[model samples]
Target: MRKLILLVAMLAMVLVGSVPALAQSTLSGDQGANPPESDGGSVRGIITDISGSVVLVEADPSASSGPKGYFTVTDETEIARLEGDIRIRASFEDLEVGQQVQADYAGPIAESYPPQGEAGSIVILDEGGETDREATLSFELEVECDPPANAAFFGFIPAEGGINAQLTDPDEDGVYTGSVNVPKFPPGPAPPGTEPVSLPVQIVQVRGVIKDFGEVKIDGDKTFKATVSFCDDNGGGSGNGGSSSGGGKTLPNTGGVLPITLGAGALLVAGGLLARRLGR
Candidate 1:
């Protein structure tokens, strides 16, 4: 009886050791190199390391069981920074280590240790240690653009291109509202000795009507304008070259996982960089 009891205990230990593998296979439903192709998925977290072209992201602790992931970003992988309604093109160099990011990819997330996946697009979700020269411009405006299909709104710096935000259709009819993000940019050089008061944004509201008259007709467009102020997030007013945080600081090189926050900005895949327009 003593010998049998000892044998049963040994078998229980082996079963416990093998439980994880069995669970993984059951969870993945496939135990090969690829688990199974996911329609598409997104991983939001902070970048911990950048080796060659692979970016190591530390998943948020709130994540079910995923801890860290390796994303392979390539030249073809689209990188964009959200500024108001526009998504500006960003290079790999723009992806500083320790910055918060969201990588959208296809294919099944690898089941291997330190799970890996191929990144199709990576977005800089947080300013992290971006310079003081940049600020975030967030705004919401009321407009009279009717028929959502014939109206568009833009927030720009005039001579230099900025960002664009799209208007939403009204459930109440004829009224449109939108929120935009303009990030990491100064209002421009301040006049000598003059505090950079406010940004003179060319708020262009374009209204157009498409006329398909026997296929030989063209559409006519009319432009309208307004002015608004954008301030930095770091307690600096719209005056004096907007305030910035994390200045003179560099990204982290720590070897630990990180956290992520998302769902506040727009993911514009509407063509390349937001069309550079002045609502003109």
Candidate 2:
């Protein structure tokens, strides 16, 4: 009986000692798995492809160069979609191709030609990092004199190329009618770490570019003006959305396996103690 009790005590000590070892092993395994923790870096680019949980990004999109590397976004990653004045919390599944994103690393990037890293957070940005809203300007010009062939229309509007449009005279009438699609760009730069603010543009000028039309008139007036509004209700926003000034921060690394490991260790220790008591 004495020998048995001694053996049981020894066995109990061995089990107690093994528990911590097991726990340590479990912790190490949980932390050491592939796609290691990010040391500290970030990449801002367009997401080109998504395979399973991995996302391929094109770091130098301006040159259409090779994809920089693959980034994996896990459940811990924080994803946000930014519109002009709205922000939506999103997930990995919500990610899609052709969208610009700023990805923050969750671990040290793999030192490969095309690097690899885990995404700690992702923010979807609008194309060109600017809010693009479109408006339409329509006008009709009546020529008092004979019209010239191959004549074009121009608008003194707030847009690129001076808001140019083509006027087509379907009938033989002297009235030439056309509409210009005007895109509204942000009036000014956005505040640092914020979205660009959009204001209404009350009025713009539309004119006839008829160089040979001796006289051009609209509503018996020499010059024509159109009212323009950039309100949200008028569908003035672009479908691609807007840019994000500041993106999400990195999240703390955590593991669910630790709790299960601790529970198993506790059970082993309890079983060992119970056996020792029985031996006594």
Model 1, 194: alpha-carbon shift in Å? 29
Q: Of the candidates shown, which would achieve the greatest TM-score relative to the real structure? A: 1
TM-score of 1: 0.32
lDDT of 1 by residue, 63-163 (tens): 43455677888667888764433355677888888787777765566766556777888887635443333344333333322222333544444323645
Against the reference, the lDDT scores of all candidates come to 0.49, 0.54
TM-score of each candidate structure, all chains considered together: 0.32, 0.31
> Who wins the lDDT comparison?
2
User: How far off is residue 44 in model 1, in Å?
Assistant: 0.3
Where in model 1 is the C-alpha error above 4 Å? Answer: 1-40, 61-67, 107-109, 127-280
